[model samples]
Target: MTAEATTRAAELKQAQAALQQGRFAEGLAMARALVQDDPGDGEALYLAAVAARYLKDYEAAEDWLSKLHRAMPEYGRAWQEAGHLALARGREAEALAAFVRATRFNPALEASWREQARLLAAAGRAAEAAMARRQQERLARLPRELVAVTNHLAEGRLLRAEEICRHYLRTHPRKDANHIEGMRLLAKVGIEFGVLEEAEFLLESAVAFAPDDVQLRLDYIDALRRRQNFAKAHEEAEKLYARDPASPVFRSRLAIESMAVGDYERGLELFDAVLQQHPRDPANLTSKGHALKTTGAREAAIAAYRAAIAAKPDHGDAWYALANLKTYRFGEDELAAMKEQAARPDLSFMDRVHIAFALGKAHEDREEYAASFAAYDEGNALKRAQTRYSADAMSAELARQKAVCTRDLFEARAGSGHDAPDPIFILGLPRAGSTLLEQILASHSQIDGTLELPDILALAHRLRGRRVGENRYPDVLRELTADQLAKFGRDFIENTRIHRAGAPFFIDKMPNNFRHIGLIHLILPNAKIIDARRDPMDCCFSGFKQLFAEGQEFTYGLREMGRYYADYVALMDHWDEVLPGKVLRVRHEDVLDDLEGQTRRMLDHVGLPFEEACLDFHRTSRAVRTASSEQVRQPLNRKGQGAWKPFEPWLGELKEALGDLAPREI
Candidate 1:
């Protein structure tokens, strides 16, 4: 740590100690100083808030908590402290609501659960009180370290959560009961940290160790699905569904996993069954709309989305799903409903975010540019606050790849990997038309279109040796033996086979794989890699407007997204220089201008004979799982072209970040 940071850490420790010892004045002074130095420090703000609450300075406590909550919206302790402050002023209803929010954010908060149970019982809500007490008992049964880990995870401190979880597991390895929960918690951290392979292995082992544990099995299924083992995930889901076909949770899991494995009919049927059980269930209705939307059931998808909105007007996901359809136009009632949801103080964070982005699209469709940008910015700001993305760190990481994956490294490792010629990698920035290319290529008889396969990303993560000082990923590529590299390549092929059928070659359209192109070449030298490029303005702005399911944190801000694009371009240029004739750069606009020519070129690059079906890509029926799924299903058009023009005045940050790479008009 820096000298200043070390001193600040010491001060924080002293303040915390004082607070624990009932020295509220001293602790408050120290915390206030720290907050003055760094107003965004959540811990400092939390300490200040707590001290103020203890001192009965309710107004000051509220101010500190407002700052803390804004800086760390999902921090359960902050909300717990808020609840305590409300109770100090005899606001039982407010305290109850705060405690409820606290538990929602972090179920490990036993105090929140206890308070909720007490408040609910006082309110004569017997069932809610019982539920809250049950939750409190559940937390009491678990290890304290797991509770801390869960709180850390809830507040987005993923690295700290992993460290505590690992230490706890190592200290109590043979305690099967504790071990299983620890492993599950570690797996959750792994998932949040994008270490999918570790997460899958951990969850799978936990499941094997406790097959009767329903939660473990559910977590295992989630990890498997994230790792793109759709069939295996579906198998696990099927087991759960068989165990209890009437369970809404199992039924929903089966429905979603069925969609993953390309059984859209079955997924829709299961969704219908769930709806039958609870017809006004907003989440299920929204999920059904998603399954319908992805499978090209346009009218059905629209109806499902509207039904969800009708059932629960504040359910923002259903509203966002309609907006995500890209071609769906919002009616006045729908627009007003979304605006109402967005304005609701009680709306959940994600629901508010979903409503904001949905409103952004709604206004954009109506050509209300300023309102559109404002809503989009609001949603992006919320997501940005929740994430811990660093553009500088990303730049440094990309630089390491360019530095370590040199021509000499390739020359020395020549012929050192498995000779896999059956894989085609479509990689680049997310909104850069990779889905379109995959659709066109998968249209060929020999090529299979798959979900954004996670195998390559998992390999890259494995290459990142440990979590110490600096990451040793592309650099570690130099230390890996030929056998190890070959095995990695072989394992990737075998693991990903579940996503493919009889096709000789399949596309792994994981856009972030662009960051690990060198790793790809080192492991599978003969695999075809396509660099899918798009117009910077359209790509960056589209990414900015998007609320990704997860990851791609850079897209939550215009400047960061633009900077990432520039870094990506520079890294790809390095790859071209070092690995000449190895990557084929395909521009989205060029493809639009000459579809048949580009199609033939891509086929030729993969050594496939040109087929008419490649040109008739939009006609090919397949389940696309990306945001651009709907767009790629229709015939070619410039629907996305110049989309940023309407918001050009508000895009100075993006233009400045893009530097000379941005369009002259921008």
Candidate 2:
């Protein structure tokens, strides 16, 4: 670490020790000084809140908590402090709500659970109190270190969690010949870190070490799913189902995995099997809706979503699912009901976020542009707070790609690595029309469509040595021998073969792969790449209004989204400069104007014949798993082309971020 960083760390440590020593005033001053020097320092903000709260400076404590929330909204300890502050001021009801929020953010917060139990009991809600006590008791059984690890994981302090979990595993080696919980916790950290292979291995070993441990098997299945190993996930889920034929969890897992593998009929059957036993299961109902939607059963999907909402009136996922259809128009009653649910302080954190996005779509559909923007902004704000994604860091990373992967490096490594041209990488920013391009290409008989495959990203992660975020990626590409590159390319093909049919060519539409063009070219030199480009405003605003299942944290804010788009464009330009004619640029607007022409261009680039089916792509029957599925199912139109115009009033930050790249009209 730098001298300045080392000093700051020591000061923060001293402040922490002061708090432990009951020197609240000294700790508060020290933390406030740190905060003044680095306003975004999450640790300093949290310590300041804790110290201020203990000192009974309620207003200052509130100020620190609010800043901490901006820095780390999902920080359980911060919310716990907020609960304490409210209680100190005799606001018992608010304290109860804050405690509930704390537990939701980090279930390992035993104090929050204890307080919740006491408050619920005082309110004479015996059943709720009993549930809280059970939760607290369950947490009490875990090792204190593990609880701390869980808290760090939940609060997105991933590196800290990984450090603690790894130490625990090292110190407790051979204690159980399995150490299931420690391994499982480490795997959870791996999943959070996007180190899926390590996570999958850990969970897989844990499951084998204790086959009857249902939680381990379920986590193993989740790791498999995250790796896009749908077939393997289904197999694991089936084992759980075998253990208990009547368990809803197993049935639902099997159903979801089955759908992932395109066994929609079997998936739907399994879903129905569970729903019949418990008709009001909102999660199952929502999953069924997703399955139906993927299979082009639009009306049936709508019904399933509506059923989920009816079963659980406050289920924001169900509400968002309906809005995500893009074509679904919300009715008056549905909007009011959603507003009521969103207004509830007792609502879950994610539920509130989901409802905000759903409300955005509802208002947008009604042409209430200002209200639409406000709701979308609300949801994005919540997400931005949670993720704490840094656009500057992202830009720096992409810049490293440009600096390391120069033309000379490509020339030196020319004619090496795998020679197979079987893969077609349709890559760019998310919401940049990559899905539509994939649909067009996959309509051809020779091309197979796949989900946004994680194989490339996983391979990149594998190359990033032990220490991540130290700029080891594209630089490491220089050290990889030709044989190593070829082997990696071969492994990629073999591992991803599960997602492919008999087609000779397949699409891997992972948008983030644009940052790794150098890595892709080094491994699979003959692979074809298609750059899906869209107008900045349309793309950024579309992304802002949508709620993705995971990742794409940049889309949570207009400025972040715009900056990311600019970085993507710069990176793509670098790729073009270094590897001319390697990537085919297909603009979304160009496609809308001349679908057949652009389709022919992409086909020609990939050495495929211009089939008429590519023109009738919307009519082609295939499972599309993207936000654009509904839009892509029908004919291409200008309906979505200028969507940002209505919300232009609130998009100044986006335009400012885009600068010269922002279109004149926008």
Per-residue CA lDDT of model 2 for 1-666, tens digit only, reads 899999999999999999999999999999999999999898999999899889988899998888887656667888888898998999989999899989988999999999999999999999999999998997898877788888888877799998988888888775654357889999999887777888998898888788887778889999999988888999988888988989988899999999998888999999999999999899999999999999999999999999999998988899999999999999999999999997764466688899999999999999998888889999999889778589998999899999999999999999778888899999998888998999999999999998899888878877776443434787888898999999998988888888888899999999999999999999899899999999888899889988999999999989999899989999999999999999999999999888888999999999999999998889989999998899889888888888998787788999999988987862
Give me the candidate number with maximum TM-score.
1
For candidate 2, the C-alpha RMSD (Å) to the true structure equals: 5.1
**What TM-score, over all chains together, does every model reach?**
0.88, 0.84
TM-score of 1: 0.88
Most lDDT-accurate candidate = 1
**Alpha carbon lDDT at 428, candidate 1:** 96
> Cα deviation in Å at residue 455, candidate 1?
1.0
Query: What would the C-alpha RMSD of candidate 1 be, to one decimal place?
Result: 3.6
Give the 10-residue window scoring lowest on summed lDDT in candidate 1.
Answer: 462-471
